[model samples]
Target: MVGARFFNFILFFAGLAVAFNVKTIPLNADHYVKVLVLFWLFSTMYHHLRVLHKTGNTTVDYGISYSLSFGIFAGPLGLFIFETIYRFTVYFNKKRTGTDDPEEFSDTFYNIGAFVLTYSAAYYLYNLLRPVFELFPFGYWILIFLLVCITSLLIDLLLIIVFLLTSDIKTVREAVDFIKSRSILDMGKTAFTNGLLLLFLREGEWGALFALFFLNYLVSRSFYSKSQSIKNKIERDKFEQMAYTDFLTGANNRAFMDKRMAELDETGEYIGIVVADIDNFKHINDTYNHSVGDQVIRHFAKTLKSYINGNDNLFRSGGEEFTLFLRNRNYRQCLDLVERIRRGIEESAVEAEYGPGTASISYTSSFGLYFYRIHHKVSMEKGYIQADQLLLTSKQHGRNRITALDGSNKQGNMPVSIPKQKLVP
Candidate 1:
């Protein structure tokens, strides 16, 4: 609440300063009306095209309207009025939809403060450089324009950093890094367009001004359309990823394994399948709780991931069960990898919370590995069944063991399990 009040106070004073600057400048009511109409049109168009996040947060709309205000020699007063009207319009629109959040109001003030400060600094620098600019040839005006644009961009970036700090949105280093990653080329393009419009406005060519306004409107529409398309693509990718990702262990889910199996079959590649199960997982769940059991599962999954190399995929097949797909690896290699993972799991301890304290719990797992060539008339399901049978054999032999089919049995017509190797520590 104190921070909110501080932001409001800054906005009040900033508004006063802008209002005072307007009073000092010669009143051109007619020109102000003309600029206001043009600004309002662009603002309205951009407003409707703006994208609103599902969370009700809105992305920052492009500052084409503000750029035009500066281009037309609209003093600080004109820009302030334009911003005020725009804010009120947005506020009322959101109010009608019952989405007018208090934070939105604060954001409006924040944006207004940013604009006034940036434009004020740019106006001051423009005046300071005008004489020096006149001494140079005509094309040198671009330099003055570039410098003023840089000043505005720098001030805007500084205010964004300050906002990040005050609102606790990010640390100073993070804010700086964010600004550094932004595209300066985009900023320069906007400034160059504004500079061109400024030149036309100075020459009193109303036709060119209106034409440029239309062109800017079209450009904004194009950008809005492209941004919407990109946003949709990102959303679709996120959904696809979620569909195939395990919620508990962060491994690929069974569905993903099925898809990969189909793809591997099409390529007719020899693949090794390994099935692993945490020994006595139900005992862990009953001794502690499901939460502790989940922790153990996640820890075990992390250990399993450590053993994966190129072209090796791990999946959470179901509760307490995991599957690994090893491509182009023979039975011996797969057996060695799974044995290493089983040893790693045994050595790993998970911190599980219980009631008032946390306790480190050591756990063990059993693995079953089977290797098969795709073109040898063996199905992926048959391979998984063979591995599952070996996994059961390990569990029966006493948990924490590996039961893998020998390489010589790879071409067998039926499922075959070799002798189990107990790895109890």
Candidate 2:
């Protein structure tokens, strides 16, 4: 990525140098100073309005900067000087704060080169269209202004895409998507503002030009604040999700399951709990090391996940143990789902390599299902306890069997074992 960015910088600078030599536009000292001051103010405002998203970097400053360069009639040299000062200021500020990452330097150089090339291209095109601007009606001039804005934006996007392609930050698709997702209204506003600024300059309306600059600053600041608020909310949501997710198996953790159970309890709907444990998990760890054991756990979790219906949720309660919460399901439906999951696990194998050879190891899981009607008012804790007891019974009888709480029994103490069948080839 660094190399790519460097190559882009070289290309931009070379093109810019060529444009400057082709037709040098004599810069007015007064206009250059005024434009530089306006550019500085807009750049500062742009930084203040910057939004840092979780996915990547984004700023509204580019639009404002480009607009100022084009509107002020700053020659290529003047624009280059303006960008250089801006880049230097940024670098010095970062250096003072001890936040000068290596990438910042590369980015600063890339921006400087990109801005010079972009403005030079726009200026050259605007000059070429000057004859048409005078020959055609006012409406044609508007079209020409829009063409200039679009051309500059395209150049900016091309540079950005090139930078992204070289970096590990984002894929080409993602970069294009991000650009496409940009607010069209914002782009239109920027383009309109640039055209207005150019008109003010042509008419020698100094007061209106400065007024518009400040107004744009205020608008950009508002956008920045709103974007920051949205970014914060998204980050908070991401953190919350991370907290509730099991890192090892990518399933909801026990805490999330408990929270979900509370929500389900309030719905007054029938709920079923199926607690599953890998049979002889410790033996796998002993024979093939913990890495293979972890692989087995993840495989089993994925297999169990496949059997879960839309109305059900899966959770990895802890090591070698998982739970499924079925909503709006009766005893029969829940049993059938659990039995299917059990059969799937019994037939599936996890392939792993040992020292020099690979082996496919088949495994089984024991399930304990406890179902409660809507009116039973059974707490999640109580359900868990009943399911756990049944699971213990299944393990006591044999490792590869299911023990289900018999709903017909009034005492709530009976668990029935499902007939164990041999694995089919």
Candidate 3:
């Protein structure tokens, strides 16, 4: 609180000094109103169009270029009047629109004071540097104008950074990203536009000012719209990922499995539809709790995922049941992979809460496999149904075993092969 008061005092002191100096600029009423309206429009619109956010107290004003041009055109006293009046207007605009946040009210004074000081500094700096470059080409005029803009930007940034640190750096990393997080290209854009505005303002070119102001807004809106597009795309992709992923096990969910199955006939690759079910999952849940049951599910899913490749997909189709779609694998490969995954599950132990502490609980699983090439009379959906039926057969005969069937033999009466339950030993 003392630190905040200290900052307030410094800012208000600078603002008050500028406030007491009531000297005026030489522009007529018509020209004065034109410049003031341009400043107001640029300032207000830029706030809405801003794509970046402040890092703590370090606010990046994209309107700094406009503020610089206005400050230099008017003197310290005139700039001071605009800053105080304009910021309060911003506060009221937020309130009228029902978008006023508490921070907006609290920071109003800090904003008015600090912005007044920043613009006032630009006014003096530009005046001091103007005569030094009188002999150089018009390029030096651009250089001096840029220096004023940069100096004002730095001063405003420094004040905010100091205020934030006075509150403390325990909140941020030592590797604080200042510019990269706030794009330098964005600042360059505003600075370039503001420089041109200043050149036309001094030359009394109202027609050019009107044209440039319109063009500047168009360019600014174009950049802001592009940024919003990228941001929305990223958010959309993230939501889609969340939708297709199982929350508990991080495996693909039924939704993605269904979508992948719908697209499989086009590939014409050999496909194996396998269903794996946890052995006595209800018993595990009854013996411990749902938390332990979840751990077991996750461990089982992880083991299954470890066995699959890029051409394979694992889905948590149910609480205790998982489905695997393996591509480009024959009957032998499908049988071997299912057996290995089943054995892996049977041999693994998951650490779970037991009484007062934790214990390693070993578990097992059963699998059913249906191997076939796509474009056959047996569709992917039919293969999945057949595999699911075989899965029920594996569970009924005995748990912790695999039942295998070739898609070509689905109609024939071949005896189902059940692997010896590994837990029998």
| Top lDDT hit | 3
List model 3 lDDT by residue over 137-253, tens digit each: 885556655765466456546544554645533334432544224445555665676678788998988889878877777887897889899999999999999999999999989
Off by over 4 Å in 3: 1-13, 52-65, 133-180, 265-269, 353-357, 374-378, 409-415, 418-425
Residue range 188-240, candidate 2, lDDT tens digits: 66567777877776676878988988887788788777878998999999999
RMSD (Cα, Å) of model 3: 4.0
TM-score of 2: 0.76
Best-to-worst lDDT order: 3, 2, 1
lDDT of each: 0.71, 0.72, 0.74
Cα-based RMSD of the predictions, in order? Answer: 5.1, 5.4, 4.0
For candidate 1, write residues 267-341 as lDDT tens digits: 766778889999999999999999999999998888888888868899999898999988877767776777778
Clashes of each: 0, 1, 0
Which has the higher TM-score value, candidate number 1 or candidate number 2? 2
Cα TM-score per model? 0.74, 0.76, 0.84
Ranking by TM-score: 3, 2, 1
**Candidate 1 clashing pairs?**
none
